[model samples]
Target chain A: MTGKDDVATLEEELPLVELPLDAWHRAKGARMVGFAGYHMPIQYEGIMAEHAWTREHAGLFDVSHMGQLGFSGEGVDEALEVLLPSDIKGLKPFRQRYSMLLDEEGGILDDLMVSRLGDGAFDGAEIYMVVNGATKYDDIGWMIEHLPDEVVMNHMDEQALLALQGPEAGDAMAALVPGTAELLFMQSGLFTWRGVPLWISRSGYTGEDGFEISVPADSVQLLADALCALPQVKPVGLGARDSLRLEAGLPLYGHDLDSRVSTIGADLGFAIQKRRREEGGFIGHARVLKELADGPGTKRVGLTIEGRLPAREGAQIYSGANLVGEVTSGGFAPTVGAPIAMGWVSLPHAALGTALEIEVRGKRIGATVAPMPFVPHRYRRAKS
Target chain B: MSRYFTDEHEWIDVAGEIATVGITDYAQEQLGDIVFVELPAEGAVFEKGDDAAVVESVKAASDVYAPISGEVVEANGALEDEPALVNSDPEEDGWFFKLRVADASELDGLMDEAAYKKFVASL
Candidate 1:
């Protein structure tokens, strides 16, 4: 739903696959759609209501379609640094970093969360990572082709991913997994509930304090039911997931961060550590450094739409009749109570408060470049 | 006066030369929450199968096509503020626009209520 934009390419000849909790989702009255080759739920109650629920309370999301990979063996850190711009060697145990897999030309292939497990844990895995659902196959193939044989990449195909996110997420998680509330932002740990092993991270894409729990596929239903039964928890679907992330100003994979886009132009230079930027040893390092030294011509920015109508993907943006860029992702922001959009624009037009125009249905509507993260991120950095 | 339905899920209530057009209940349901609707202006002429109106949900936007060639007589002003009316009463007050029928013969190609019900069931 986030990274994939190729709905027309869905191979109707190929049968859609069901997730581990497919029956449970149907029983809960989820409106399912074929997304990323899986019959994933688009909404439960409705997109607006579900979006509001996640901003006020806890909402559960089934993200099992994503590919989970584990890497182990000596020299794994040094090997991973060769593919990513992040300083993988400096990653502390139980901490995670946001990084991207870059093509040799410096374009991003996929964005991922890489977490180093506590020393000598999870049998042999020194690092565990989660990649976008649609690009996981290619991401794994890229790593297998590049990673040295000493580092063994294990694909956790039999596991399911669940994200419990929002303001009340801490309370709901604490009720089920007692120690989860103590985990700070970007930290992860191994835990057990009813003897089912879980690898949970205190992180999410919703710009809220939450946890992404990885559990055995067979026992996901039991885990989901337990969480949903809590007072503040409800099952949400991909519809809300997208709207929430958009409000948080996070980019979707296929729409905003395609293979042709660079990390510098995407305004994601924070992912590269200071040491890595100066050292320049990772893939596409030359281009990244050049772009860093000399600013990118076009930069990604947020837009505040003037009218009620939403400017969706591919809508043309203009600066007084001269086309500047196109909208990447946009919709009615339920929480912000206005129409907001994100797109890439020319450097001159990308400044905050710069007035612009968006042609929706041939009528030009007024818009202005605004600061991102339209909704303030409420991440809990430490135990309160 | 008889009611006709199109495969695209639009319904037309034919009364003499004026035809009341609206999407079926199934379509409003399928579209989920109706947030915005772009109704064609009065006097706008549309050919059969031309894009008549636009409907937007929280997730995506879709086009409502004309079932028969006609000129728009009036659009439902009530929907400009209360788009959810399409979800609540799609057959009655949720009507999109009134089209002054260009050719009554086009009605013969459309399915009746009974046929539309069966067509929907087949889907």
Candidate 2:
């Protein structure tokens, strides 16, 4: 629902695929919609109610459509280091870092999570990564073409990914898996549940305490049922997920982040650690370095509108008749009780507290650049 | 007052020349969680099939077209603060606008309550 602006292109003649939990979702009375080439559940009861539930309680999200990739063999770290901007060579086992794939010219190919795994872990994958579903195929192809032949890549197509997110997620998880409470943010480990092996990470898209569990596709139904059985955990659909992430100020890959957008321009420069920036070996390093030295032409910033009208994606942003930028993602943020948005505007116009206008229904609504996480992030980190 | 439904799922309760317009329950359910509604100005004129009010849900913004030509007499302002009325009572308290009927003959082309129920079944 975050990218409904681009959903028209999604309904092309391309056939829709069914989810592994297609029947489970339908049985729960979910409203199925074609998204990312799959018939996925957009919502169950109602979007607003589901949005509130996630902020207050645990929400189980079926994010299996994302690509879970496993890499092994010789020079695996070095191979990935050449493709991503993050310092993969420095990654510690059981640790996860946000990274992005870039084209030769430094255009963002896709944003992903890269994790170093323990020996012979998670299907013997030395390195585990998750990429956005809409751009997964292209990412796989790009990596395959560039990676050394000795380094092997496995697309875990038969695996399903689920995210249990919210302030209550930790308590709910500890009830199900005892050791899960020990994990700090950006940490992960392997565990077994009811004889099924799971690769879980203490991370999520929503800026809330959560875990992303990787389970075999065939066993997803059992896991989903068990999670939802907990009084604190409810089955949430993509609708709530979209709203939660938006309120958290996280970008949806296809809509907010795209090829034309650079990491610095998107305010993702933190992904390029100091080591990677100093070494400059990854693809798109030139642009990253250039943007670092000379600031990106346009910068992504958060906006708060004056009224209730939501300015959705593709809505043009203006500063008194001058076209400055366009909305990348936006909606009525349930937690804020008002409309919030993220858009890329020229550096001069992207400053905080700057006045702007967004054209909705041919009328420009007043807006102001604002600091984000429009709702404060409630991530639980390791005690100092 | 006679209630007539349009193919687009708008309902009109005709009482003499003045009629109340609102989206059907089915339309509101499909839109999902009414977040905002943009109403047309009172005394605004419109022709049949012209763009009118917009109903925005958490999902998407959908246009509720002018099912028949008329001049707007009044718009339900309560929706400005509480759009959920459209979801809870779309036929009564959820009314969008009132139109002074341009032509009563236009109702002949639309469906009655019974016909609309059957049409909904076919879909």
CA lDDT scores, all candidates in order: 0.90, 0.90
In model 1, state the lDDT of residue B36: 81
Looking at candidate 2 chain B, the ten consecutive residues that score lowest on lDDT are: B55-64
Model 2: per-residue Cα lDDT over A286-314, one tens digit each: 99999999999998999999899999989
DockQ computed for model 2 against the true two-chain complex using alpha carbons = 0.46
lDDT of 1 by residue, A1-384 (tens): 011222333435557899999999999999888877788988899888999999999999999999999999889999999999998999998999999999999999999999999744456599999999888999999999999999999999899999999999999999999989789999999988999888999999999999999999999999999999998999999888988999999999988888888999999999999999999889989879988998877888999999778888888999997999889998888899778999989888989999999998898999999998999999988646
Among these predicted structures, which one has the highest DockQ?
A: 2
Q: Write out the backbone clash pairs for model 2.
A: none
DockQ, prediction 1: 0.39
